[model samples]
Target: MSYRHTLTAFILAAVITPGAHAQSFDPGSMKTPDGQPDISGTFTFRTLTPFQRPQALADKVALDTEEAAQFEASERIRLNRDLFDPESG
Candidate 1:
């Protein structure tokens, strides 16, 4: 009797487990009716605004367009100064 009960429980669990946790993927979820991947919007993921200003530019609250451009150019030059220097190890 105990063996019969154990067999029944095992069979029930085997039958019920897969459907209980099954997930179906819909390929049309992020696609248009024309079958193209629908990525239609302007995303401001990368903005020109800085998250946190550095302590060196602390006193300056904001920079005009040309001032900001020059600042960025100088920063890039300062950072990549040793790019082509052979002895900059």
Candidate 2:
């Protein structure tokens, strides 16, 4: 295509594309007191906390300080990307 034709098509698409991606949402729902849309629930918190309790710790609701320290040490090593083998990644 000629440069002029390509530029005209690009400009036309840019003008028309926004409406194609328009979204609708409830105006009244999930608003904060200040009236911004409440996005408090949008985040999924990341933590090193285990998804399932270890079998030995199943009866425990929370780890005692000594146990917590040990768990954190192991998790630090496990989560450290620098410790990972490049091939494994």
TM-score winner: 2
Question: Can you write out model 2's per-residue Cα lDDT over 1-89, one digit (the tens) per residue?
Answer: 69999999999999878866565556777899888988786554367787778687888888889999988877766777578675854
Pick out the ten consecutive residues of candidate 2 with the lowest summed lDDT. Answer: 41-50
TM-score of each: 0.32, 0.37
Cα lDDT tens digits, model 1, 25-85, are: 6768879888899888886624544567878789987888998998876666566676745
Question: Which ranges of candidate 2 are over 4 A from the true structure?
Answer: 1-46, 81-89
Q: Candidate 1, which segments miss by more than 4 Å at Cα?
A: 1-52, 84-89
Whole-model lDDT per candidate: 0.76, 0.78
Cα deviation in Å at residue 63, candidate 2?
Answer: 1.5
Clashes of each: 0, 0
